[model samples]
Target: MNGRRTIGFLLLIGLVLWGCSGVHPTSNAVWIAQPEFSEVDNRLYSARIAPQKGESPYFSFFLLTLTNKSSVDLVVDWNASQYLFNGKPQGVMVFEGIDPEAVKNAMVPLDTVAPGASFSLEIMPMRLIAWSPIKEKTAAARSISPGMLPIGENGILLALRHGNGHITIPLSVRISREGLP
Candidate 1:
């Protein structure tokens, strides 16, 4: 009986530890359902953005997938990419040398997406001073500048120039103390 109790206690402790690891086993990671798609110059472009695993409040990272559904190839200029917060443009943050392997793999080489193919990339926007819902509510109380508040109902806009046209996708991200989903 004592041995069985010990085993049960150990199993309970193991379960607790797994839950605290942040990486939920059951796909608990938040994700966006409907990706934004637009047609420009007879080419279809779709984009999906989501928070990186174990995202931080100080600096948030996002995973992006750009798909090309048209018969023609498309090129994306990463240098010209912009992130708009609440209809206002914010500074773009470059990962530089600290980029992880997964992030590197996600980066589009030459910013090109072949016909009927897709490119995965990682984008880190400017420093988000108030990402958590609780922090958002207490931002004024904490004296954080209003401009630094996280993008809310206005939604985040990702604009990328492709060839002679441009593709703008609006992403509605829900951020909480836990993380963006």
Candidate 2:
């Protein structure tokens, strides 16, 4: 009985530790691109790109900060915005809206930026997930060869639509393994 009790205790402890070791996705990834600030229509816009924590290597997050300098509310259509990665256009994924709690503070609501206020927009790339064997085969057939992109030397472009016009910001990211730029 004593030996059985000790074994059960050790098993419980192991299970607890294993559960704790599971990765909980966070937004604390290394910023590959420094924040780039731009001023348009008296409003300030800043953008940056970073790899999301606990996600695939290709998965990234584009963060946008918009500050309303004008005395009037600024309307932004985040859903209609576009992102270009190294000249390749990418579609925005709607995962955040599907599971808001999973993303935590990383999820940003699309709404009006009140006068003298600011708002953030987080964007993720669309990824195709195969659910069935046939779908898996189809996806594999259509998938392009996986390759490593030199993110350090690539350029990222973000086009965000505002009330009247759109703001285009180009981010030139230079990264080094030794340190961040």
Candidate 3:
């Protein structure tokens, strides 16, 4: 009986350690979902933070998918929006393409989506990214570096506007990773 009890205790401890890791086993991107404020609709407009795929070694971006389930136009107010990282205010920039040198500290303008349409935006933390130029062989290239936030709970707060007032969506995620991969 004592031997069986000892084995059970070991198994319990192992399971606890595994749970503490808190990482997605299969997919590359994993965000701990927020039960509230994740998905909201201002009568006719709706928005949600879609899952991000294809994470880079120096990861610093979020893919947000917005849908207009109503029959009218909606606008994503970037001016009234904010990025929430680790429960703090973070500046963000939305842009197209994957060029590292092209990304700047400027935020993307407001998005006006037609009725019954869906779209996605690739957003990155402005201050969380660092740029450096390096010359190799005979050419100079720029590299986008990651911030100190390698592991923690981080997310973004989005603002959507219409003819009336506006609605806010807050997405929080739990991040776990090795330091600076």
Q: For each candidate, give its TM-score against the true structure.
A: 0.47, 0.44, 0.57
- Candidate 2's residue-wise lDDT over 1-181, tens digit each? 9999999999999999977986532323343433232223433543445433233343344445667766665665445444455555454333333343322343434567776787765444443222233344453452222122235433345555555777665543443232233
| Best-matching candidate per TM-score | 3
Lowest summed-lDDT stretch of 10 residues in model 2? 142-151
Q: Against the unseen true structure, what C-alpha lDDT does each candidate score? A: 0.51, 0.46, 0.60
Error of 1 at 152 (Å): 3.7
Candidate 3's residue-wise lDDT over 10-59, tens digit each? 99999999988876443343333333225555657566653343354323
Error of 1 at 33 (Å): 12
Off by over 4 Å in 2: 1-59, 93-95, 98-110, 128-161, 171-181
State in Å the error of residue 116, model 3: 0.4
Give the Å error, residue 40, model 3: 4.3
Candidate 3 wrong stretches, greater than 4 Å: 1-43, 51-55, 97-108, 131-149, 178-181
Candidate 1 lDDT, 67-142, residue by residue in tens: 8877676676544455555556654433323233333354533467888888776555534422333445452443
Candidate 1: residue pairs that collide: 106-120
